[model samples]
Target: MYPTLRVRVSRIEQLAAGIKSFTLQPCDGGALPAFDSGSHIVVHMDQGRMRNAYSLTSALDDRSRYQISVRLEEASRGGSRFMHEQLRENDELDIGAPANLFGLGDGAGKHVLVAGGIGITPFMTHIQALARQQASFELHYCFRNRDSAAYLDELPSTLAPDQLHLYESDTGGKLDIDALVASQPAGAHIYVCGPQALNDAVVAAARAAGWAAGRVHFEQFRNEVDATGGAFEVALRKSGVTLQVGADEPLLRAIEKAGVKIDCMCREGICGTCETAIIEGEADHRDQYLSDAEKAAQKTMMVCVSRCKGKRLVLDL
Candidate 1:
């Protein structure tokens, strides 16, 4: 289990027109735990009623403070809006320890980073690490416009001019996925984080360009929407309880409503914090955290958003 710490915002800065970065300091005035590039924290808010995930935008060597950038999402579930508009310096927030599914390769020859919009948060740390080590890398950033791009002024100075590529859709220029994939050197490791469309484009382009599967890595920044809300019954064998999940309700909410406890971070199905074992039944896994083999096995499910295919599911809750 991850340790939860209460942190206070010591400073806040507007990175872009709609983006704000908050520097958090430990309330106990102690050194924060060490974290690597691409690590993230789960923030508890609304009196623990909601938990949201945010990528760390600060350097790993800076243990005294950690920073996270937030973009005002219009259709947000109150977390981003509260962080951007309501939260003030000196306010306290419950934060989880750093957890990372994205990290630099241990022995990769070349690093190719592709970022879009707010996805640049994790790439910031990667770029800092690469710069310090003088690693061979390139960063391709895609945004809707320059005004909405975070750390625009700070990034260019950190990365080499030739290694950085920026694209703005509103400016009639988009990320040239074909050119990027074609330009990648042999045995190059590709890392991409962005919207679903951008991710799909990169994956498709890379595959079409004959890039190996193991050479490509991606992290999604959006939730998996459930279009076919199928009703199902979940049986918690360990607890000797069962619950009926409505078509619109998620398995996590239904189980929690029955007094069962399950830890979750990003309820959008991106984080794997709420993963549980399935003893029986076919799980319609919708999360992006699981590997292709894991999804094919159907032994585990992300209760936050995944559902059962049949009428009943036996879970080892």
Candidate 2:
């Protein structure tokens, strides 16, 4: 369970051309919730529960503040625009308690970290943790140009030469995904956070290099599911209710209309917050969070992006 707290934006700085970073602190001047590395808080921005989950970029030891970077995307759904334009310093806003889907690998002494664009947010925690522990680690950040990449100046100054590498496409610097994975030791763990293409490429390269499944970690920040998907009927077993979900409406929204509230962190289905047991129907799973084995099992489905394969479906809700 996550508690909602009101926090004031202490500072807001433009990190890049399109990105703005905000520093938030508790309104009451009390200690904020303690969080592990790679945690995020859900910011509910509207009456319809329009929320955006942002990675906490501040260090874990910094209990006085929490930082989040927002990119003003051209195709944003108003969340980024709201933060970039309407939100200001000294304004109080509601944010959820920190929750981590990506935790540091303590058992592995050697770590390889990869980031693309804003995916660098969560890795700040990982880098700090590894540096504090004096563990062996390397980070590769891929971006189109320096102006577009957030934390461009900050990371290089903080990290040593052997710790960080920046690959700027504008400078003709390319990342050899295949070679990078092959160079890592067998005991090393590889973690990546990026767009679909980058994430897929890294995972594929690592697997081809014989990296075990357990040794590879990733957190996809984008949800590429098509919103104009076909809809169907859903049956709630415990509630004894059935609702008709329109083709244009997401399954999660349909369920919410029927008075079933499922706590959702990232509505994009990447966080696995809305996974529900499938009582007796096939689901067209469109989420990136589920593993191959989980998808093959067909026991659960992520309602945020997934839909029914047939006319009717039963859920353990």
Q: Which candidate has the highest TM-score of all? A: 2
RMSD of each: 3.3, 2.7
Tens digits of per-residue lDDT for model 2, 139-164: 99999999999987788887998888
Instruction: Tell me how candidate 2 scores on lDDT.
Output: 0.84
For model 2, the superposed segments whose C-alpha errors exceed 4 Å read 223-233, 244-249, 253-265, 280-284, 291-299, 308-312
Candidate 2's error at 74, in angstroms? 2.6
lDDT of residue 55 for candidate 1: 87
lDDT of each: 0.85, 0.84
Worst 10 residues of 1 by lDDT: 220-229
Question: Where is the poorest 10-residue window by lDDT in model 2?
Answer: 222-231
| Model 1 regions lying over 4 Å from their true place | 223-233, 241-250, 253-267, 271-274, 279-285, 289-299, 307-313
